[model samples]
Target: MAIDDAISFKKLEVFLAFMKLNNMARVSELLGVSTVSVHRSLHSLEEAMRCPLFKREGRSLIPLQAAYTFAEFAQRAVEECEHGILKVRETAGFNAKRLKIGSLYSLTLRCIPQLMIGLKLRKPVLDIDLTLGSNRDLLQQLADGKLDAIVIGVHTKSEFHDALDPELLSIPLFDDDIFLAAPLNSPYSGQTQINLTDLHQEKFVTLADGFVTSQDFWYCFEKAGFSPNISMRVQDIFSLINLVSGGIGYSLLPGRVAKFSSQIELIPLESNYGAQQRITLLLPKIRERDPNLLALTAECRMYGRHDGKKDGFL
Candidate 1:
């Protein structure tokens, strides 16, 4: 007598046929002639309500009042079942795959680009997204899960060493010795090598804040007993090297990047000038065994040299 008394649409169809024909044999013949099946459908309809829907009268089955109520909404229940299936299919297609990596602006220009190309050549389907940031910023992003990894300077006593996990891995990629880059033909270039103390009065064009090299540059100068004569601050190494080529102001840079200009003299500092800096590939110790990272680390090692042959800077 309520909405819960609804019956299946298939059962409702059998009741409709019985009502229209008034004879089980005639209903079965009109609906494909299975008299036994027609009887079973009516039996199930009665059991569902704990009451008989029809009784034999002169050999013809008759429908009860409950049958009329049950048939009224059977079609709506079938429609609701169909709609629920469509909603689930709509939600299954939205997630896409991609990997995000972060790196210093310096490496992004050269090292990372080369390595990514190599990686692409080998694995073209890998979806890679590279983010450029200052070394410190990239390191922070890596810790926060915004990046999978980063490439930057490695220092044993650096603030990061304390923060990295126990298995923190470091690979000596190349020697990134800080050099005094001066105009190639400048009077200062003729010297076989320069001592850090002698350059105390030289003008310095330093990297703007947030760079790992900027920190190391100042640290080295202080170690040599002089404060840098910072004449200007620049955001990118390529631009800074171009400025150096014009002889605007001398700057400090890693040996590999010093290759930016054939006109710039890269003067390797003497020991008293400062400690030698090691350019390392840093990653979680756990990833050390990952073939892809390991392979790329090897790629770095392959291109990592600054042959004194280029300009005899050493």
Candidate 2:
């Protein structure tokens, strides 16, 4: 007879428990069954194995030599089955050892890479999956449980308070000042400070509507008391920077993006339009204590603290 068809793993579990505990009442309590049920299960296991598993001695069940040998196989089989299940879960991403992080495409230039380096130093064996997209997309994925955590830019304020979902937790990473990215040869590029109104007649390239920087890009023109003649809208910040480099148009972005290219000049704007944007780490409040997330969060916080004092915004 085939073992799978003849023997029940459940009955074997009871047999194992009884063999170790040596008490029908204790085995039943441990398995959440009655003494009668435990006795029946042990008998069933013995019948399936085609061997006597126990010998009775003064109302007590004593294991036979056969019982010890069978138990060794049974324990190994049970443990292997459990390990198989865990492996399947990990492959399906249900229970995973890898950490999933989400962020804006821009941060991959600096902040994201730095954080990953710091995280690896502390958790050498930890694997990380970094997903980059718009702030809107990242936040939605985080809410749907598709991402472990997110790093994105928030509106900066002196008080450093961020308005977010109550179920989410955020840690401020760093503050980055907003600047205008212009073609290296543009007249504005030579200026130490470019007034927003100076770009009234200039066409601009920008990220699409869903991006946080896109909104902030427009808001600068609005605050400057004029509307930008938007020439093109793209999906990624790097592409937008490339467009500016080709003299396609000027664009507004956070200071962190300035390091990505030498073809464009990152010019500071006047106070009326110059505002610092806050970079923050966002994760579900429920998972705040998860070991990987906690370690990543700590590394991010430390990176921000140290980098802010040096180059500013890691």
Most accurate candidate by lDDT? 2
Q: lDDT tens string, model 2, 1-314?
A: 56745477888798899879999999988989999998888877778787798898988889999999999999999999999987875654443578889998888866788899988887888889999999889989998878989998877753434456779888888878878898887887578788899779999999998787887887788789988898899999889999999999989988877678888888888888877777889988877877778888898789877874433423
Per-residue lDDT, model 1, residue 264, is 87
* lDDT digits (tens) for residues 1-314 of candidate 1: 56335456676677777776778889898888599988888888777767777776875666777666655554456566666554543232111134466776665546677767866665566577888877778777766657655667654345645655555566555445677788878878778677777767778788888786787787778778778788889987887888888878888777767545687888777766643445556666655555555655666566565322232124
Q: Give the total clashing residue pairs for model 2.
A: 1
Alpha-carbon TM-score of each model against the true structure: 0.59, 0.69
- Candidate 2, which segments miss by more than 4 Å at Cα? 1-95, 157-162, 309-314
Candidate 2 lands at a TM-score of 0.69
Off by over 4 Å in 1: 1-97, 108-110, 156-167, 285-314
Clash-forming residue pairs, model 2: 111-314
lDDT agreement of model 1 with the native: 0.67
Give the Å shift of residue 183 in candidate 2: 0.9
- State in Å the error of residue 264, model 1: 1.3
